[model samples]
Structures are given as structure tokens and as C-alpha cells.
Target: MHGVVQHSLIILAVLTSLGVIFGLVLAYANKKMAIEVNPLIHIVEDVLPKGQCGACGFAGCMAYAEAVVTNPDVPPNLCTPGKDPVAKLVGDLTGKAAAAVEPRIAQVKCAGTHTKAVKANEYHGVQDCVAANLLFGGPKSCKFGCLGLGTCVKACPFGAMTMSEDGLPIIDPDKCTGCAKCETVCPKKVIAMMPIGAHVRVNCNSHDKGAVAKKACSVSCIGCTLCVKECQYGAIKMDNNLAVVDAKVCMEKCDNPTCLAKCPTKAIRQAVLGIVPGNEETVA
Candidate 1:
């Protein structure tokens, strides 16, 4: 028994010694091979929103901070969630010329409410939009319309989206950070980023032909090309049986918007400027 105990102790001691030696070697190697991080990276990252929504085309805020500080090619204004104020701060820190960040907000392309849009079938499985969309392009008769499953609402890092009683998503422009998380997660591609300054916007995304689109949804764009013809600035265009508005051009040049009057189904509507969503009071 004494000899066996002695052998066990010897074996333990040998294993312990080997472990300590390997640990020391690893510690030394780690110290020697460690890459020095620039202090400016942390400083830049500190000013970021830190939502890590990947809106800036980087993996996270830390990666963006490193790129903006180390890479001259990376723009400081790439942080969409941070807006112009944060962009200015990053640009100042990096000593780069900061261009004015265009303020953007997520807009719902489809105006199809429960009453307006026809239902093809009722969903019985998961409540996720992506999952429902996979099953025969969702329950909506219009395949391009919002699934109304609240996937975008859940995905939003910022509290910008909400489901209306009408079975449509209402976007709060004030809360929207333009992260595009809602847009990215939407399987129907109903959500889109639009400039906050844009007043006139198309409320439909359906690509179905005039009669077919009307049958699916009352407000679907019918590709009449009337908006394009009405606008002297050439801002509106018909693409895949839908009317698209160039907000920049329309906001800049067009004063008398006859296109809003020209849309037969009223798919194109102007947002009542300064009116906050969910508020009954009109902004005077």
C-alpha cells in the first residue's frame, strides 16, 4: 500500500509540473504575440450606438470602430443608427471629412389592411413571417404584401415598428434608427428605408398586372405610369408593375404634385408631414 501511494504521488507531481511548465510557456507566448490595439478604436467605439445591428456593413460596433480608425477607405458616416450627430463625432475623432448623413426611416411599402387585402388562406403554424412566407408565399392574396406576423416588429433593435389594428405595420419615424433590421428580416420585402424628408411615397409593392393587382389588394399599384407622366421632374417610374418615387428629386423640385391625384387606386399617398404615428391629433 505504501509503495502504491508513493507511485501515485510521483505521477501526480509529474503531471502537475508538466501543467505548470506548459501554462508558463503559453502565458509568455500570449504576451509576446499579442497584437497591440490602437487606443483610438476604443474611443471611437465608445461614441457608437453599440446596437451591433450590422447597419454599417460591419459585423459589430467594435469592428466598425477598428475599420474607421485604421482604414482610410472606411467612412465614419457609415453608422446609420447613429445618424448625423454620431457621424460628426466619429469623423471628428478620425480626422475625416464628414458628409451630412441623410436621415432615413423605415417605411412600409404595403398599405393593404385586413379589409382591403383578400386572404388566400389562414396560417396555422409558427407565428414568424419568414416561416409563414415559406408556406406558399404567405396567407395574403398579394404575395408581395406584408405577412402581418410581427417578425419585423420583433427583429427591430429599436422600437420603431408596431402592428396596427388594421393588420398592417405602422412605423414610428421618431423611434426608427434606420438600422434596416426590420427591412432585412421581412420575408415579403415590404419594409424599406426611406429618407425622413420624403413626403410622397408609394404605399404598394405588388407586381401583379393592373386587374390582377386590384383583385388581390385594393391599394396595389397598377403601373399606370400616370405618376411618371404627371411629375415634370421625372422622379417617378414604373418598375415591375409598381410606381416608385424618387423622394430626393420630388422633395427638391416638385412643388405641385399632380401624381397623387393621378393614381387611380390611390396607391401613391403623401404622408401628412410632422404627424406622429398613433396620434389622432393633426399637426398644425
Candidate 2:
């Protein structure tokens, strides 16, 4: 018993000594290897919206904060969710000129509703847009149209997105921080970021030919080029059998938009820039 006690004491002493030596080494290494992060990074980060949406091209708000503070080349206005006010604050703190961040909002490009769009099949799998898209571009006959699985609604960090009774996502421009979280998460790429002051929008994502698109969804852009020809400002263009509206051109050049009237399918829509139409129903 005495010998065992001595051996145990010796073992404990050796362990204690090893632990102390390791602790001292780690402490020294930590002090020497520590990279002093700028205190201003935290200050900048505090001004951020903390959406961590990665709209600024960084991984998260902290990464942006570090880049904005440490890198002179990085512009402080990269935080899309933070908008102009936060840009100004970050600029003031960093002594950098923040170019005016054009106020932007996310808009659902597809206007296909439950009644308007024909479903190819019924989906009973995982309730995710990305997952749904994997099984043959979702149930929607229009390959590029919104899947309407509430993935964008779930991904929205600002709570700007909501599902309509018509099976489409409605974006409240007021609540949207323009983080583009919904835009990034959407498998169909149906959500788009638009300038806040722009009124004209092409509410279709289907690039299928005119008859094919019409067959898939009643509101799909038929790519007739009527809107393009009608626009005196050259605002509308055709690409991939879809009408693309140049919002800036339409806003500045044409007061009375004739494209809205010319679109046979009524896919081109004009709305009050900041106001969302209907009670959670997207403008169709």
C-alpha cells in the first residue's frame, strides 16, 4: 500500500508538471501569435444589419467588417442590407467615400399563380425549392418559373417574403432589406433585385417559346417583341424568348408606359415602385 501510494504521488506530480509546462507554452504562443484585429471592425460591424446574407460578397457580417476596416480597397457600401444610412455611417467611421447605394428591392419575377400555371406533376417530397427543383425542375410545367415551396419565404432574413393563396411568393418592398437572400436561395432564379424607383417589371421567368410558354402559364412572357417595339425609349428587350425591361430607361424616358398595354399576355406590369399590390398576392 505504501509503495502504491508513492507511485501514485509520482505519477500525479509528473502529470502536474507536464500540464504546467504545456499551459505555459500555449500561453506564450497565444500572446506571440495573436493578430490584433482593429477595434473599428467591431464598430463597423455594429452598424451592420447582421443579416449575414452574404450580399456583400463576404461570408458574413464579421468578414465584411474586417475587410472594410483592414482593406483600403474594400468599399464600405458593399452591405446591401445596410442600405445608404449604414453606408454613410461606415464611410464616416472609415474616412472613405461611400458612393450612394441605389435603393433596391427584391421582386418575384414569375407571375404564375395556381390558376394560371399548369403543374406537370404533384410534388410530395422534401419541402425545399432546391430539393424540389432536383426532381425535374419541380412540378411546374414552366421550367424557369417559381416552385412555390416557400423556400424564398423561409430564406428571407428580413421577413419580406410570404406565400400567396395563389401559390406564389409576394415581396413586401417595405420589409425587404434587399439582402438578396431569397434571390440566392431560389432554385428557379425567379426572385430579382430591382431599383426601388423603377416601376416597370416583366413578371415572367419562362424562356419557353411564345406558344410553349403560353401553354405552361397564362401570364408567361411570350417574347412577341411588341413591348420592345412599342417602347419609344428602347426600354424592353428580348433574350431567351423572354421580355426584359430596362427599368431605368422606362422610368426616366417614358411617363406613360405603353408596353403594359402592348404585352398580349399582360406579363409586363406597372406598379407603384415601393408599394406591393394585393393582400400578400404578387402583382400578376
lDDT values for all models: 0.86, 0.86
Please give the range of 10 consecutive residues that has the lowest summed lDDT in model 1.
275-284
How high is the lDDT of residue 69 in model 2?
A: 92
TM-score of 2: 0.91
Error of 1 at 242 (Å): 0.4
Could you tell me how far off, in angstroms, the CA of residue 13 lies in candidate 1 after the best superposition? 3.5
Supply candidate 2's per-residue lDDT for 154.
Answer: 95
Give me the runs in candidate 2 sitting further than 4 Å from their true place. 1-13, 272-284
TM-score for each model: 0.91, 0.91
Where is model 1 more than 4 Å wrong at Cα?
1-9, 273-284
- Would you give me the overall lDDT of model 2? 0.86
Could you give candidate 2's per-residue lDDT for residues 135-220 as a string of tens digits?
99899999999888899999888888888878888778779988899988888888888888776788888899999999999988
